[model samples]
Target: MSAPFVLLHPFAPFPLARRTRWLWLGVAALALLLIAAAGQWSARREASFQADSIHRAIEVHALALRGAAAKYSYLPFTVAQHPDVLAALAHPFDPAVLQRANHYIEEVNRRAGSDALYLIAPQGTTLVASNWNTPRSYVGQSYANRPYFSDALAGRNGQFYGVGQTTGEPGLFLSAPVRQGAEVVGVVTVKVSLQPIQEAWGFVRDPILLTDAHGIVFLGSVLPWLYQSRRAVAGSDLDWVLSHQQYGAHHSFALLPWKMDPAPDLPGFRVQTTIDGKPRQFLAVDEALPELGWTLTVMADYASVTRARERTWMLGLLCAGLLLLGGLYWQLRERRFAEQRDARRELEVRVRERTAELDEAHAFRKAMEDSLVVGMRARDLDGHIIYVNPALCAMTGYRADELLGRLPPYPYWHPDDVEQHWHNNDATMSGQAALSGFESRVRHRDGHDVLTMVYTARLIDAQGQHSGWMSTVVDITEQKRSALRQRQHEEQLQHAQRLASLGEMASTLAHELNQPLAALSNFASAAKAFAEQGRQELLVSSLDETAAQAQRAAEIVRRIRGFVRQRTAGQEDCVVGALVANVLALLQGEMRQQQARAVVRVPADLPKVRGDRVLLEQVLLNLVLNSLQAMQATPLERRVVEIDATVADGRLHIQVADHGPGIPAALAEQVFAPFFTTKPDGLGLGLNICRTIVESHRGRFTFADRVGGGTVFTLELEVSG
Candidate 1:
């Protein structure tokens, strides 16, 4: 036989307590059922209490309606007994009797506060009315077939509600007969306004209604409900209601909205519906007005009453649930507190150990920081200095006391850097700046500018909030001065190297000047010989040649003078082809003397390069002359120098290629080094200066061996559009 299976659930109070969950659930179900039964009992009791209240209210309002009607109900009978009313009927055509009766009824209607009081002649014609003086007078109208009129003619007092044939207003028509000894001579009717009673119902805060026998609501507190049928009328009832004009001729005759459930066995007279968009349960009750053949209804809302009981029951249930939960929570909370206390004790021990390690680490860090040469400073979000290490004070020439809690621009900041300092402060505080390195100047202790390179990052506290920015700064003032001095020394050396190149070109320049001078001298001799022969044409030709040679010599002098002129850093757009042509012209005589073939190849439309025109010209000249000197070891027939300019790599590339032995691979890296040269009398600063000049223009100067047994030096300069 199989052993009984037992379940053990982790959430159970005990290992065997899983089955108790269902028992608890069963109890909850029973409790809900009891609560529901209690709610139903409470609802029934409330409904009964509400029904009785509605009934009492209906009876109370019924009396108010009667009192409103009684205000003018006796006026018609009293008018019937008047002599003027009888006299008006006796001599119906006499204006005097009509006037007197109309005035008398007007006084009665005014006192009764009724709509109108009028007399009907025996011929069914309205002879006079209280409103005879007004335009809507009923003096000539007929109500011959009216029940009230017929009943009065038959010698009985009658009451009917109908729309006036003359005036369109609806009211209660009370009629009484005038007697000529036992004969029914005429009828007197009174139209007592129902508006006052309707207004009274409005003050009671309950829905009240007065409906006719046909279930048509003739008077009601709500204007929309007035003259509406309480139920759907059909057949003769609808026709009679219409034909009799029980309601006004303009009434819709539609059924009012009852929205009732037809289910049997529903208790109480409560109706739950929205009235004018307000959801409410109204206790509806109707009472009979026996004399008027009308029903009076009164409605009272019981929503507040029901809600109060529901609120009380719900509050009790809530308090009970809370008390139970509080007990359970107290039990579980103590266990949790024990576990938490153990955890906290363990955490406290671990924290103590970790804190000791952290303290040791912090001590080590403090020692390291004290020994550091770089300065450490921190600023809060508002740009106020919060911390400054000893190194920072030394770097800024300020004491810790002076710098702490100070705001920028700090006194130690260089005067020229104050604006930049403020800008950096704002950018840092606003989180618009990145963590990177920047160079700034601060005042030194000796009253001089100290340059510092700072690396910074935003400071975050233990809570991971942006507390401020921490910056590490290194004083680079001496380094910067040394670099400046080195640059000046290099500039002087470059100048001296350029002068040496000029010095080397002295022999070539002298030979170039000798040709033009010799030509001018020969032309002068020719002019003198022609002058002796009296040949004017020959002498003029000689003089023209002499002038041409003189002009040629002057042009060479001007070009060389301008090329050798020294200038500070300056740049302009130089057309590559034109610049190449100018260099060639300056070295024209030298190339011819060297017996070297110089070829210039450049795109006619090559774009311009931006650099100092003289510097670039010097660079080109130096490369070409170096190529010529290199070719001295080769045969004169193999010597060739090529100057080529082209656009390449979004830059202006000008190459000087020579068919000379290329540089050895091992020494190629050192080709651009200052004072490095293979020539016995050459200063190696030429290539270095060329590279520096190109770099200063944001370009490059490099050399490589050509595939065709030659060395090519290339200058790549930025192209300016």
Candidate 2:
């Protein structure tokens, strides 16, 4: 029998009290289960209601969008059949017919409130436009590439939503064939801006988005949701959207840079993200707008669902608490009748338990002594071992039989310490000095000396007479050697740090001197020309300017020292073109030295990036210099480094490509580690620091081999607005 049951079995309690307790518990559990089931049912009902409401709201917005689209739907077709439009299409270049058609279309556009009304020739040229007086007018712009133009020329009415090529504004473009008798002559086109429809959605006070067939969200109630993609798009498909500038200069279709995870076993997803530094959760639903070939996604506030669930649980808990109180009152009444007898039997059980506890404790002490990490030994006053634990035997690599009952000069005592061990034991037995702490070396069975810590205590019997001495030993060899090695390592580490600091200081000074020294040379040469021309005033101004520039060069040194502790450089928004031009100016000397040619490719309207200008200049300068040095073995004529910059997916990607021997694949991963270098004289921090600066700005940098045979380093920086 189990000890607990055997002990309590002799003195039993009233059986009805146990039954009463179980009955109350069963009732409480049943009520709790029922409450939980009801709450779950209510939650399901609310979720279904929410889904239906979203479907209805999406349907309402779809109708509203169709209504707005219908307002100007027939305007394109009506204008195509006008007598003057047909006549102008037939005459081709007749000024009178063109003037009449333009005036007629302009009047109709003004009355219809359309953004633009234009007449396209059969050759796809715009002959007239309603906004001819505006700066972004499309009077003579070519529309041959537009899908709407081709569809209309093929004798079918077509509708499209895209960014205008001439105006760069997003609008719905509609076109219809202008028929001359039984043949298509030209096209009548009308463009209606989508700004009004999008603005109208803002009044709905909920997140409602409309995406085209391509899943591009061109119209939306949420400001951040506009012009975003509903799903991930591959590079090829994204390139098509970018090539046409479908939605102005925007990159990427992702509504959020992160993917949203859908809730398990639920119809809607739960998105948890930070808003204004505080976390928020949103539940969203998607529906299709079949009439317009668009998909509508509506996001609703889910706080209400949570609130309802909380209320249900709160009510259920209150009811359960009331039922528990009633059960406790009955339990108090039933406690009075519990059996009250058998004092002698309880006393007998207690005595047996006490005896068993003592026996268990003695066994526990024996096991602990045998398994201890520190060695324990006891010896008699006559210097003969009386007792020794397994731990002591293991410490000296011997069996208990070999150590127990051994004499003062034990086999485990080191030869060099044998006299010291006996002298300490004699003192302890005589009480000349009260068994103090000491250290000594011991010989292990493996025949090696190990440093051990020793402490002695008196082993007295029940009569309080000294019977023996107890000694505990521990191995300290590893600890002593570790401390020595640590001291040596710290000294070496300090020296290495000192060397690194000096190297950085020298490198910074050299780079800072290069720029100003070059400028000073140019100024001095110009000064010579001024003096030769006998222009005293110009020469005096040049001398003064040169002096100021020389002082500026010294400031660079002071700034670098001051910036040692400041890891993040000062940041400002910078234009890509201007940044490239400045860095190329700094690299002219390096290019000349290496006999390398530099070619820069950047778009004028490329997105601006945010970073510290000085730090960025340093990063670019290092890359260019590396490229120049890497091609030192190449023929002078073939030493070309191409600097290319493009904006895509909200990132400004800059590629520095060189035609030279590429890095070996084996060493690529190690090149970025501090102190790892390829060149004999390389500090290896050039690429490391470049990557550090880029990462500080939340950007990335990577390296690859160019297709023709060289290396290409790509730097990706986030675009600023």
Candidate 3:
């Protein structure tokens, strides 16, 4: 006996009720059996419907393939059934007559994309050919032995499917005899490609197995893995089908049991229609093409059919059980009287005990609710707020009474966050999206902002129906403030570093400016010399070269101004290599002053990045200057500074390393800090600014002490591509 049954006592008032309850149990059992029968019947009905649908889909595929094959047959007949070749072959062909035959072959070749077209003479000699052999090799070649030529020559019109002699592809060969006074004179041969027919059968999802009339599979597109394992229609299951009488008919169905040995078994199958020779099964649908003696097939797993049937059965069972219980409870009043009396008395006792339990549960729920640190709110399926916990009220600075049932577009949500919050929250309420946590911001009642992290899940009601969503939110305001301040400090540091770079390069700037001015003077002198000698070409080339040099000078001055000058803060897309080349050109004189040579190793295909060209150049200039300074103490051979630009982790990386002594290990981290320095008369802002510039471009800057003596500084900037 069950524990609930044992707990019930058959005392004076309950003895009669106990007897009556047993009578009702019997009635319930009868009702349950009827429900189960009805459920299975309904399941069988739905299974028939799905099977019918599969059958229709199979028929549609067969019609489509037949139509495609018919087109292939029609094209060859149109080309082969022409009369112009009949008249020409009636008489011995002169060279002119043979040339005319070639024109007919060309016309047929164009009408059909055939690989072979030819005309056979009455004497069994090939007269003209197109796409047959190079230079019409078969023109004078004998066709006395070939089936296509001889069969037509004997006054028969027919077609043959064979492989090509040279191309070795499946081809449909059609031949029709040209008649003269009811006697055959010549045969027209047309060979067409069969690739389109294979393509038409490719629409099926599963493997296709096409067998000839002799039960030999001639064409197949089986799955690679299954092909490797060699499990196919010719295997055991198919052999069993062939042995069974049910499979021997034009249309009959059977379910056979089989095991999948090496592979774990999926849901077992409930097979549908089966047949042998006939093409009721999709795998053999086009097993016999009247023109080509070929077949088309598509094979699907029987397990899928069974699983679909099972799901329909389960749905039917649930619906039947609900209907049966509702009908029996309403109709069987007299039979349940004694049982009802006992149940009422027991219910009275349970109600009193349950009332006390409910009171205790309510108190526990309140305690749990108070302990929550995140803001909590619940909304019904209709999108009406049902409750708001104290934490939520405290977060939004509103009382619980003010928030409950106040529909969304709640004043506590920021305008920008409102749409996203409702969209994400509604997904949980509608039971469409999984319970994924999201982050958003809400406006406080006091007009301040509150960044929040929210987690939510759906709540189901007593009837096992989806009811609402309950969301928990936590404040992230402090984290947001910290990030904001950090970004501001980085921007200030970057600005100070840019100013310091211009100050340090002031002397180098003067030397760089003098270059174009000197070039202009030389070009002007050359023009004067050419004019005096009456050399017109020299004057023209000299003036052109001077203008080019002047433009170069102007560009250098503009880059210097752009570097030192402050402009509006905005990021522009620039290629890393192009921008680096401009910087190297600007710093060419400064590099020469230190007797240091620079090697720019930026790849030509480097990705473009969004950044301020001036600030990026400043960072590059600082690293190059540092390299030049470090090499000032080294021998001439070690003075080369290598600047390389590459992409890593979806970002651009600029690495500057010199061959001179590397930085001391102790100062690596300190080098980027404001006012930190290792050199005499240094403000130590270059490395710090480099870090700031990189960060502003959404990047990072780092320095590593070289294995030798010099320092290597790297700047990283993001590349959207």
TM, every model: 0.47, 0.43, 0.46
| Cand. 1 Cα-lDDT | 0.80
Candidate 3: C-alpha lDDT: 0.67
lDDT of model number 2? 0.77
The candidate scoring highest on TM-score is 1
lDDT of 3 by residue, 1-721 (tens): 5876666653555877787778777766776676566655554554455445545655665576455445445543454456555545754457666667678777667766666777777777777777543643557766555556667888765554444443446555667676667777677777666565456555655445544433444344532211111223445545443443112231212212212232112211232343333222221122345555545444454444345556655766676667667767775866688779868988899999999999999999988997788788888887778988888898999888888887777778787777787886567666665456777888889988888988877777899887888788888889889999997776666666666666667787777767777888998999999999999999999899899888987887787767766553467888888777877887777777878887888888787888877778778888887888778789987898888888777678889999777876676667778888877778887877777678767788887776667777888888853
**lDDT of candidate 1 over 1-721, digit per residue (tens):** 2333234334456644566566667766776666666666676676667667777777677777677667676777788888898888888889888899889989988877778889998878999898998888888988886778888898988889877767787778888888989898999888877766776677777677778898888777777777678677888887766666665565457777666543123333566656687776666766889988888877767675577568656865776578668867986887699678768878899999999999999999988887788999899987788888888887867898888898877888778778898877777677776666778888886697778987888899999998999989899889988999998886677677678777878899999899999999999999999999999999999999999999999998998877766654467888888778888888777778788988888988777787788888888888888988888887889888998888877788889999888999999889988889998888888898888878888888889898878799988888874
Backbone collisions counted per model: 0, 1, 8
Off by over 4 Å in 3: 1-361, 364-373, 394-398, 408-422, 439-451, 461-465, 513-554, 564-576, 601-619, 644-655, 664-676, 681-721
Least well predicted 10-residue stretch by lDDT in candidate 3: 223-232
Q: Rate the local accuracy (lDDT) of all candidates.
A: 0.80, 0.77, 0.67
Instruction: Give the residue spans of candidate 1 off by over 4 A.
Output: 1-12, 15-363, 513-569, 633-639, 648-651, 659-676, 688-710, 716-718
User: Per-residue lDDT of 1-721 in model 2, one digit per residue for the tens?
Assistant: 5999998876676586688778878988898887887677666666666777877877777777777677788998899878888887778678888888888988999999998999999888998778766787787888887878889999998777888888888888888898877888888889888786677777875567778877777888767666767677657878867765667677777755334777555666766555446555556777766656777777666566666676787788898888788777666655643542445578689899999998999899989998898888888888788778887777788888886677767888898888888887677778664455777788999998888888888789989998878878777888889988985664343334324433534644576588788888888888899999999998988888788779878766555443333333468988877777766665554566666898889888787899987667666767777788789899988899899999778799999999889999998998778777777776666777778778877999899999988899999999884
lDDT for position 325 in model 2: 88
